[model samples]
Target chain A: MEARNIKLEEIIRDENLVYTKTSLMTDKPLSFCPGCGHGVAHRVIMEVVDEMGIQADTIGVAPVGCSVLAYEFMNIDMQQASHGRAPAVATGIKRCWPDKYVFTYQGDGDLAAIGTAETIHACNRGENMAIFFVNNGIYGMTGGQMAPTTLPGMRSSTTPYGRDVALMGNPLKITELVAMLPGTCFVARHTVHTPLAVRKFKKAVRMAFENQKLNKGLSFIEIVSNCNSGWKMTPVQANKWMEENMLPYFPPGDIKVNGEMVSKTAKSE
Target chain B: MAKIKGAIVIDIEKCKGCELCLVACPTDVIRMEKKVNGKGYHFAYMEQPDNCTGCANCAVVCPDGVITVYRKKFED
Candidate 1:
């Protein structure tokens, strides 16, 4: 029992260290709820920036959502965009700084609802920037309201009786719609539920950054994350629910790689 | 032969006690502490660290990003 009392400072040795928090992230604690996916998503993105040696030459656009304060956590040049206007802001940043890596962090509500026009036009014009979309189904920040990406039959604050497809219309599959555009160079959907998923998502982010270096148009990555607080479940339960309900509709895979749509059967695991 | 050993450190105060790492860990190396942290949450700690493989699954899935893992190999 006493062995467990060993202080962290006493046990940490540089030579034996296999993993540590990336310095690219600020020391500030995350504002997300306990067990939310946004924290992991933020870490992976920062880790990729750190690994690519692009921290100094990268600019991020934060949308109006739970992660609106993303700039506070990520130690990089960041711009705060109005609701659903991240793509537009990112476009301006990319145009002004063509050589720098530019990206937008948007929630489903911000990207699919309010900023639909900006998102489509940006993708259609083949803006040389990365778009990181966090799709948590329901709106997390504004009190668990139904969003454009909310699943059918899912119970949200606005749809307490569960979303009726006939009345509410079908949930928007914006990722697939963006993939259909010819301007997108690398379009993929991923979730950060497990270690394997995190690895794949990290690779996708890395590829999106690399695509900017090659001037390969736009790279869009939709990360289907969990909103435990909004979903009315524990962190673990929400992930399980997402796997059973969310992943089926928005399967994690590369929708478009290098300007070509990945076939339905040949989607990467 | 080489014996691989791994250890982890958790910033107990930062931890939200979400237990995501507990589920992600393959070797069952982690367990929740009976004592509560300053936040009154049951934070995670290593209960059976000898089984850890330094796979980093726990750290990768941690929402709070509080866990740090280390590994080393010793000749037997």
Candidate 2:
């Protein structure tokens, strides 16, 4: 009997792959945790930019946090901003280059906490830029400290006993708050826990970038992600936990779409 | 109906062995290799290639962006 040997290159040449990694990503491996949603979010944004054919004209601002090194992973023109200052940097870049596509990749700790003022004012001023906010409910890079968006009764390094609304205040629904502002044209909350969720997230991200080309006001996309290392749960378990706990407080869907607030009934219907 | 075929190429060194892909694969074609990589983590491998439907669900969910999927099409 003769044994036949097949090479991987031949298989790749012969097969019709429906999906493959995008060139927008860098050769460097992502430094995010194994199950962290930050990588998925980064890939989605890069994929959107790649598909839109704006890699050369796109400029990304990454604030301090776990996503601080996003510039390394996203193969495009990028700038590093101080902690909680991506919006300010993005604003400046967008103002200087109105024709260029500018965006800010931020984390909950940077955007909702110390950068709160910048975030609110950037949207209020209707900065023509896309803001990708990754909300993991905890300070992932700072050893799982409680963030301003940390849900009530959630446990963190700072809130060991659990986040008490009376003591820690309620979770900040910054996405909804931004939706109320007139400057914001698109505001949506999404997750990356499942294939369906990832598809929806990609659509939202693409829409946010499209709105920028329309010269619409700010487009805020809040991705409710999980920090497995911070949460002290396996990646799979953390996703399950997020679906059960975080989804209720931060429901996944568009809070505002195309300058119109999507009512709760409309979201359900 | 024409039979559909799927295949995957994994960057072993890039895989963290998180097993997220294991759960993402709808057809259970993926599994963790017994051999560990340079990072001392088991890498993902195709245990049952024939079962893959080229859904790309595992690639979509992979945080490391290590998996690349391929599908073969047949005319009905």
lDDT, each prediction: 0.91, 0.88
Q: What tens-digit string does per-residue lDDT give for candidate 2 at A97-193?
A: 9989999999998999999999999999999999999999999998999999999999999999999999889999888898999999999888887
Show pairs that collide, candidate 1: none
The estimated TM-scores of all candidates read 0.96, 0.95
Q: Which docking band does candidate 1 fall into?
A: medium
User: Which of the numbered candidates is closest to the native, going by highest lDDT?
Assistant: 1
Model 1: lDDT of residue B54: 75
Candidate 2 chain A minimal-lDDT segment of 10 residues: A1-10
Put down candidate 1 lDDT per residue, A133-224, tens digits, no spaces.
Answer: 99999899999999999999999999999999999999998889988898999999999999999999999999999999999999999999
What are the DockQ scores of the candidates, in order?
A: 0.60, 0.60
Candidate 2, CAPRI quality class derived from DockQ:
medium
Q: Model 1 chain A: which ten-residue window has the lowest total lDDT?
A: A1-10
